[model samples]
Target chain A: MDFWSNFLINLVQGLTTTLQILVISIPLSIITGFILGFARVYGNKIIFYISTGISTTFRGLPLIVTLLILFFGLADLKIYLSPFWASILGFTLCGGSYISEYVKGAIQSIEQGQAEAARALGMNKLQEIIYIILPQTLIRALPGVSNEIIYMIQYSSLSFVIGVKEIFSVAKTFNSLYFRSIEIFTTVAFVYLLLIAIATLVFKIIENKLKIT
Target chain B: MISDTILNVVDLHKKYGDSIALDGVSFRVRKGETKVIIGPNGSGKTTLLKCLNLLVKPDKGRIWLGNIEITDPRININKIRRKIGFVFQDFNLFHHLTVLNNVMIGLVKVRKLKKHQAYKKAVDALSTVGLDNTLYHKYPAQLSGGQKQRVAIARALAMDPVIMLYDEPTSSLDPQFVNEVLQVIRKLAKNGVTSIIVTHQIDFALEIADEIIVMHKGRIIESGRPTELLSNPQNILTKKILIRNFRTLR
Candidate 1:
């Protein structure tokens, strides 16, 4: 096969893997964030402390360390995770921690009266959070969550370290084989840029639709 | 408990870091009666209202809503709250929701009404509060303060609560808007919706109150029919509060 055609086929294959990671990880991370954030804010003392600890520990570690630990370090304990699963788990923990920080702040910024009003109307704690609090928190946390998503796309390249052959990894392999360093890497960079641009536009549209006004 | 009494409070006491908010405050409201509570700030009128619904748990008190001892830890507070509608001074309308949805939420979520039924009830309650159809789809942020308070009232009213609690329902409104909210409350009062209102508006209180209870320093200083209390106040503090309201209004 010609160099450009061979490279394009491999790049497309790698792009699929990257999209898979994002499709699964984004929702997982968001769910993780809401649970941890809400637990820290409104949970009982024991739950609050535990959730706070989890968020703090994950956020403190670098994403690369989290991925490495999940993929390789856990093998010492005979806990096996595939490179793909390990990458997903690591991204979820790290990204979720940061998202939870935004979630926590957003939840706090809502007036106490909002919760009180829901309670007065006989909504249980869960109902209040689901129907009233979460909707408002999501809107307030959107800007920060959007930033995390953009970062997630960029950092997803790091998964190649764990042997998950995503976009950047495909380009790196092509570079070694053809020694076309500039061409291969620049194409990879543009792919990431395109993905982030699309993500940004999607989030912008959501933010506009959900604007309280 | 009296057969017709909807709410009964006995020896309610609350202290926020040694500043006594409600000191042995006690009161009762009969079915379909409007009992107006007048007091200065920090005098515990708001605190008393909160304790009735267990929003602010009393440091020491026993409250009976209908026949249930709501203050008891084993009892279901949510069930009790469903029967009692609370309107906050600031309106506290769910800002993200349209006026219609704001009223429909409690009906659907708490009352467990069907969507169509809840929507119908919400519309009825909104109309009862004198809100126009044009405002139904608008968010609370798009409405005037008076309109927001009316929506808040409709939100509570849709639950078909046995009693309504108003904590200065019009205090957050602009001067021009207060009368609209007051009119809604007056209409509800005339319709015989049992309520306990805490307000600085003594004139409105006198007009609608079956009985007026005066509070001072976290205690009920006096209680009687509005005319009787106004004509012959039993406490110097009551006279001063009534005088203050008159001066503020004038």
Candidate 2:
């Protein structure tokens, strides 16, 4: 009973850090994704090439390598960032690139006639995109973005490697001290499952609410 | 150049790769004149309308909306477009918005009308297109093809455009629903809404057209008053189109 209580206390504290990272990272990643996606689709040639390069470079690199470079490699270059900030920057860049691909695909799936109608109605290109196109694109992109968000949640554990005592890291510390690998790891897995299930439900509710009749 | 001419096209030409869409097409539409363009497929009727609305840029031509030369690069296309309404064949209503919002969007966004004013104009336009208040809150998918097209027309009309362009507006509709859209166009034309309509419905065109222009192979093959063209067609293609598509002429 004492072991369970101690583990639960550590679990709650670790979860608070994990939730903090997610709360900050998710919205930043989504904003980054939209900017990159919009540039790829409607931007001029130079902007298209630049955004495509950014998306490809980040998506091609492993998330661990990105986090390590951001945290350690940047320190060598005299650009120090806190472990928490480095993890956020890494996740946002990598996750946003993947999310951008989904956004590009969704934007393309919208009918050409839709844009033509808005332009014919005297909407400037920017107004047409914001008012006529993005609303529909976001709904189409929700499932893909939700998948990315789930991946980000699972990967948030990696921040523990950089000294953030999130759930997985806390579990590792407790297992080392008490040698209760089964109990500690099992609890961590459950925590991740719970987070993912909650995320899926939240995304589904959003999709349903925004869905075109 | 005529004082009454609201739109004029001079030596209009367009090409997509090797194929010519419009070649040396020219015409003038007087204020409140309903000009109907009839042609076989690939004859540039739709392209001509798109050019006048500046939706398609003409490779070689000059177009004037009133005294302003629209083909000039300095002209703001968006500003010109606001005054020229276009109703597409497929309706192209914004699926995400309600019927009322679809019409109200342009009025608010382009015309800068307040929400209440836009709502009033949208409802009036919807009413003019024969759509009742009951349909206002429904989405595009919830409406039938006819109702969707009516909403598209109301969306354009709510802008209070100086001229309206219809590009095969009823071609996608079921036969039973075609007359309803045509009736709206007929009513608008009778009220003296200047328009250029491209359609296969030659009979309806004859009824509303102040003058009918027949196009073939990217050129104006013939044009005249409805009765004159029916009585004496200058081009064989015109006679063939009139016979094939015009039920009354047959």
Candidate 3:
């Protein structure tokens, strides 16, 4: 096939698979991260320790190691997950930890006065966290969370390693058939750039809407 | 359950590290009466006001807000806090919320009022402090210092607390903005909200206080009617503050 025909065929397959994984993983990681972050800060001693331990452990381990362990090790226990599921599980484990750090930092940056004011108003602990602290925290966490999504766009390429046939894997197959390393890789870079640009624009609109200062 | 005292503090003591912030301080506020506390910067006046609502728990003391023992570990402090409104020095408005929401949050979250009911109360409270409907939607950052403080006052007032505590409510404002906040506070006291105010504004205290208490080194040195206390202060510290005030004003 000609270069244009080859590129177009690989692009469709690669981009679609990459987006499918990201579309589901991003929301799951964000929700999981928020709960973990809140638990790390507000939970009882046992819960706080457990949440902090999980985030710390995941953050320290390399993503590839986690994926290898999860994909292969699970089989020994009679649990079966496809390459796609393995990629998602690994990325979520890593992404959830990073997002939790962002959320925890955002919550900490809020002044002590906000909590005091909330309590003085007669809000119970749950109500204070839900109505007052969480709204402000999410607003503060937006820039960090946006950056995390951009990271997801880049890191989704890692899914190719597990034979998930994401964009990078498709690019690799296309390069093998055509023997065009420079051209194929350059196109992949631009595809990521395009995704980042779109992400940036979406985040900018959200940041403006949520800004308190 | 039926008590004329709006607040009572007995043998209140708090120490930070090696320093004593409040030492055996005691006072009582009757229903609908204003008690203005005056003192120098390190005099523990702020600590005393905070301990009333258990904002800063006293190391050793008993605080009674009506019939509930606020300092007791068994009591739900949140319920006690709602009945005793506190206006902070820095306004402490929720920066993320609009002025209306700032006033309404306590009503909705604490009082558990319906949104429309909370809305009406919020508007009434805001207008009570002279904030018009036009500024209701504006955020704290968009407001002037006086306006922000009024919103803070409105936030507390919307709860309809039986007692209000003011901790230098005008302390953070520009001189031009101070009078507006002071005026709103005076109106609350006049309209029969029991109050305990801590301020350096001696003239304003004399104008509004039903009783004036002078604090020095974590102790009440003099307590009496504003005129008598200011005119014939017995303690050297109170006399010094009074002399300084008169000299500056004259």
C-alpha RMSD of each candidate structure in angstroms: 1.6, 1.3, 1.9
Q: Indicate the residue-level lDDT of B200 in model 1.
A: 87
True contacts kept of 1: 0.83
TM-score of each: 0.96, 0.98, 0.95
Instruction: Please give, for residues A107-208, the per-residue lDDT of candidate 3 as tens digits.
Output: 899888888888877778898899888999999888898898898889899877778888799889888888898888898998999989998998999899
What residue pairs clash in candidate 2, if any at all? none
Q: Please, what are the lDDT tens digits per residue for candidate 2 over residues A105-189? A: 9999999999999999999998999999999889889999999999999999999878888999989999988999998998899
> What tier of docking accuracy does candidate 1 attain?
high
Error of 3 at B69 (Å): 2.0
Query: Between which residue pairs do clashes occur in model 3?
Result: none
Question: How large an RMSD does model 3 have?
Answer: 1.9
lDDT of 3: 0.88
lDDT of 2 at B105: 95
Q: Which 10-residue window of candidate 1 chain B scores lowest in summed lDDT?
A: B241-250
Q: Which model scores highest in TM-score? A: 2
Candidate 2 docking quality: incorrect, acceptable, medium or high: high
- The candidate maximizing DockQ is 2
Strongest candidate by lDDT: 2
